[model samples]
Target: MDRRTLLTSSLAGMAAAAASAPETRAQAGGSGPPPFAETMAEMTWQEADAAAKSGASVLWAFGVIEQHGPHLPLGTDVYIPSAVLRRARQILAERGHQAVILPAFYWGINQVSGAFPGSVEVQPATMIALMADVLSSVKKQGFARVFCTSGHGDALHNKTIFDGVTAGRAASGIDAAVLFNAPLVKRLGLDTASPAVLGFEVAESPARFIDVHAGDPETSAMLHIHPELVRKDLLPTLKSTDYGPADLAEWRKGQEAARAKTPLGYFGDPASADASRGAARLEGQAKAMAEVILARVGGK
Candidate 1:
């Protein structure tokens, strides 16, 4: 059998074995632990306090609602971060670490898609304020180690979010840290070059699907994560413009180059994306993120 088929079969067998194994307590048998979903929801004030008392780290997924070419949904940024956080939590639990992911922040600065339909753009200050409040709330609950992760590629926006988190940490006197996964992906030696674009990889991986703007990667990820949200047959074929942050002032020049670029707001080839590759990438990202948390919070 091919590598994909073999890997899938092996994973299935391992899952079957795990399912058949008797449940074990965290303190006694040291085997199975509570599933991540049980801890990631919006908890009551008292619940948050109790979790904080347990000294667990809080991971917040920062996302945005922006236009992703013509094929991908506006909430692609939001969903991708959430997926990464969930996967990270699973990995942490397996390693006997107490970490819980929080809901994502969907509003962010979106200059590229500001003109697109259904795209919601927030002021940089507004994003900073909102994130500060969210982190403050988490801090109030006694979570000393606050971790935030963003999937959005806007470097400035992410910096603002991190800055806000820093303000919250200082104001609340809580030991908190924010992580930007796009940068982390690069630090982990992942080939995020033009061909092996991280964004495209995120969409196609098993944990999600490869739906480039609504093409393959992003569409495939949506298919795997929330298949009902995808309008697969209604794929669009409009060309997208290529305008990076550096080309903001020279609009005419950028637009001219954009005309010759790919139709979808995507980089790299999405045709090669598959569920197995997506799953593996997700796992790698989660592991790298967890290590960052551990290092920051005194994990051995």
Candidate 2:
């Protein structure tokens, strides 16, 4: 048999066995937004085999450790998306699809934010190669259906991710779908989908006034997902700074230009952030993504 055919056949038998056998820790009863049920990092090889056998659609997320002004943690990107995907998994399970969360790919290319302190970034090419290799690994592990999600939103960063997906699918022949928020994807204007590299889109938040980095949406998201990580005290003094088209063009001229435009490393109005809005943003984004994944993959 060819690779996909062989893997599918093996899963059919293993799934039957898994269904008849006792539930592993992954299937144990839980409540209230619990941790990932089946993670590659946490599962034993035997348990992972059972997960593979269960035909769970594998999921992985991408983020970066970087400055988000002075109020949010460097891990703001990682925490928010991980929370969103955790909720997405719950929504998927409710719709009768088993999705296993893989450990997140947190290290990422940080171009716009590279000028800031604590911004650990890799070259764009490095990110692209890593994406290709990671997806290839997933395909080799017999996970035929997979999804990639990202929390970071830089146009260049996302492009590298998209290219990596292309290279990975070309190299390994897995049917993987990547998802991103619609506005940023539209802004990037990337031809983001193909048969081999399917992707879905969701709105990152409700309509915002003057939306930009480390602003209301992002700050509120961190407040909702990781409240302790937010510097609530500093929020009161940070003023609103909007970067219009011309302003952004000027800002991107160089790192010094960007830093000069936004001295404290933030843009938009952060003092206006609200945790209630944050909760709603999380629910909206997570639900939109979950619904699409169910429609696209259908428990495959």
Candidate 3:
């Protein structure tokens, strides 16, 4: 069977099995938000206002609708960040700190992925404006700590959003503090020497030695967190390309050469992906993110 068909069939079966399984408050033996049923709706204004009033820290997961390889969902970018935020919320709840997770931002700057079908690219200026407006609204509601998490591959775009939030705070004199997920990811060590590290590449250094895009780490992550979304069986086998010696100079040169050389718009080995790897990466990211939020929220 084709990858898509195989993925669909497998996911359908998994969902059915999940439905038949008994529901529980905790599955991973970790603590955080009380349960999915207990947390408020992540996206609504009313929810944000209520959460702030209840003394909860506000966290937003920024995502984009972009192409992953032929085997992954277009919303993979969105799901990864959202999953991290959800996991963070759970961790914070365990520490007695209430956290309100904002909804995922599916529209983002996706120039590289724009050539692919189903990818939507928002202009950089447009994304900055939208994020500023959202944060402004949240600050006005008295959310003291605002966390911005992104899973998209564009480091520059993510930095723009972070700078925009900083500018918004300065211009409006809002007391809110914004934290981006990229630095947090690095601090957490989830992308350590893995193919997914390329996800951190920017236009300045488009080609990194690691395959950060739709490669092993990313695909593995999807397989673990949202297995239904990955079509592993139907994916094309890719001949792995190394950007020569791994260094900053070579990395930049490789990225420049890659833009002209690779047409698929992805790097890394997807065949090596596994659900267990994704779960480990996700847990690491969540733990590190939770610590940051707690520190920001003044938790001990």
The candidates, ranked best first by TM-score, are 2, 3, 1
Give candidate 1 regions above 4 Å deviation.
1-42, 182-220, 234-272
Which residue runs does candidate 2 get wrong by more than 4 Å?
1-38, 196-209
Worst 10 residues of 1 by lDDT: 194-203
lDDT of 3 by residue, 221-264 (tens): 77877675566566557655454345323323433353444456
Tell me the tens digit of each residue's lDDT in model 1 across 12-32. 999999888844232233222
Q: Give lDDT tens digits, candidate 2, residues 190-235.
A: 5555653344554554544456778898998877876766778889
Highest lDDT scorer: 2
Every model's Cα RMSD, please? Answer: 15.9, 15.1, 10.9
TM-score of each: 0.66, 0.82, 0.70
Q: Rank the candidates by lDDT, best first.
A: 2, 3, 1
In order, candidate lDDTs are 0.59, 0.76, 0.64
